[model samples]
Target: MPKIEEAQPKYLQIAHHIRDQILRGDLRPGDEVPSERQLASSWKVSRPTAARSLEALSHQGLVEKRQGSGTYVRSLEVNRRARELYGRAKQTGKIYTPGEYAVITSAGWLEAPDYVAEALGLAVGARAVHRRRVTNNDSGPITLSTSWFGPEVGERAPKLRDPDRIREGTLMYVESVTGRQGSYAEDRMCARSSTDDEAADLDLAPGAAVLIVHHVVYDLQDRPLEFAEATYPPERWAFEQGYPIV
Candidate 1:
């Protein structure tokens, strides 16, 4: 548990307290956090101040506010690895972090799907190195992704066709062999009802809401290297991004 730092803002103190509880497993998904009234009474702060504290937690994606009920810890955790894979490219050579499972279900050359073609700037019917993978967090399977690498990437790194987890992760291996490091990436995300196959893969009920993420990775030369579509059960994963508004 985090001690309330006297110098820190009151809202930060509260946010840290809640965040620590979640991290330490004291609070589980769907667990109700203390209500603002309870917090105000306990912390001796105004109700507005307590509400602000919860709002801070909401902004951090640690809690969700229900319509009738008070705030609760989110069922999903923010996927820091997903963001760090590209965000820290310049500072670190690492691609994936530990504590996750990656299983390659399929990998081989395949005709690019329409969306993959568009994202990778490949012509329709172009053959690309395709890889299907399932990723699991501590809770369980969280993401199913299909990635397509452009010919430039495939020709440079043939091992991408291997049907196994790349020990150092794809980006790290690609950079080591191709020297085309992922300098940055663009992502689009949306939520929609899961298909039967998707539902089964994610162990969710049919028509349950799922999050989809599309990513395009670019090298330092601004050349497209890979395009991918990743699906996640909303209750198992959360996404976050931070960038300067240039």
Candidate 2:
């Protein structure tokens, strides 16, 4: 058998093909899209290629993938429900107010990564305090935060560096020192199978859920001051972002 060669990016081809179907009304709004395996067989491509195609479609707002359920074409009639999950991850279980300070501490070993170095204008391998805290809400089990800070600040404010101290707001302290506040927050959310480490952190059952989140808080100057790799348990938290759904 000759190896299947990709004349075009498999996902793009699949997306264009499916899009054509939609445009032609063959795959109407509210239509049930083919499953990954089905798409693979139909296109004679691998499952991964088919999966990517579906994901591309979803990103383009052409389809929606429900957890554990199959993908479906979105209705052009009404918008998909979007909710900005406010952080309830404090013992007080309240929205964070400006000037409120949250203690930072960690559960495991913490070290700054290269990305942090670049963002914070620090030398690579320069010491930075890192912390991972298990944040909780009134309902319980908020997302886990792996936060980092430059050595100057973290050394001066140990509580700000400790992840276990896990208070209500750290952004306040951030503002106080930097003399600035975050103007825009950038989040890159992605759906993925939960790994063992992620499962334990998010308190999820094995192989039973998708983890979604990418939180980047930038200062008024548009410099990335705080970067959080937040992991949410499936169905526990819904992310809200201003994505053009056209």
Candidate 3:
């Protein structure tokens, strides 16, 4: 398998680093970014590479370049889109968003719940690997996510059963171990009251309005490889997307 860094262009790697810093609040809005010369020197890359990194960030609306000045972090207050999140994960080989991290609250084999069983095409009460996590950023917990995998995936990737973060993200690691490349995904979302457990993990009052997203990833052969459910506080989080309707 190719190293994660080797799979991404050098410029994108630099851009991701800066983007992470900004999202983590290490580089706040309006802060002047390092010059191309400085970045090239620091990263041991060409000036053009450094320039492209900044340009990429600018195109994403995460930074602004001022004439005669330099690139600076932009002030952004926008909804987090699921598509963007997945794209970033695919690019960076990381499931956690920039500046966000997760704590694996639980990981082990469990009887697949009805919904999970249906999603994974397993019989009800069938054995599966279940991993629960709470993702947080600087403010506080942002989401509570639970992922279910078929037993064979657990057998192939033992790390899924460990109560530890998967550095390459679960699906990516599974692909690496089982040679099942993810081809597409399906997502279903709803707005509803948070359950007791979800409320506790998200630090919200029970019955608070929350957004629930169910995601299923399929391998190249169109077999479901992972089923995930994520809960978010509607007031603090949202999924957005834009497209031209012609």
What are the lDDT scores of the predictions, listed in order?
0.75, 0.59, 0.80
Clashes of each: 0, 8, 0
Candidate 3 to truth, TM: 0.70
Model 2 lDDT per residue over 26-55, tens place: 565678898999889988889999999899
How displaced is residue 215 in candidate 1, in Å?
0.4
List the pairs of residues colliding in candidate 3.
Answer: none
Would you give me the overall lDDT of model 1? 0.75
Which portions of model 2 miss their true places by more than 4 Å?
Answer: 1-109, 118-122, 137-140, 163-168, 237-246
Best by lDDT: 3
Question: What's the distance in Å from true for residue 141, model 1?
Answer: 0.6
Give the top-scoring candidate (TM-score): 3
* Candidate 3 residue-wise lDDT, 156-216, digit = tens: 9999999988887777788899999989989898999988998999999988998888999
What stretches of model 1 exceed 4 Å from their correct place? 1-76, 86-99, 242-246
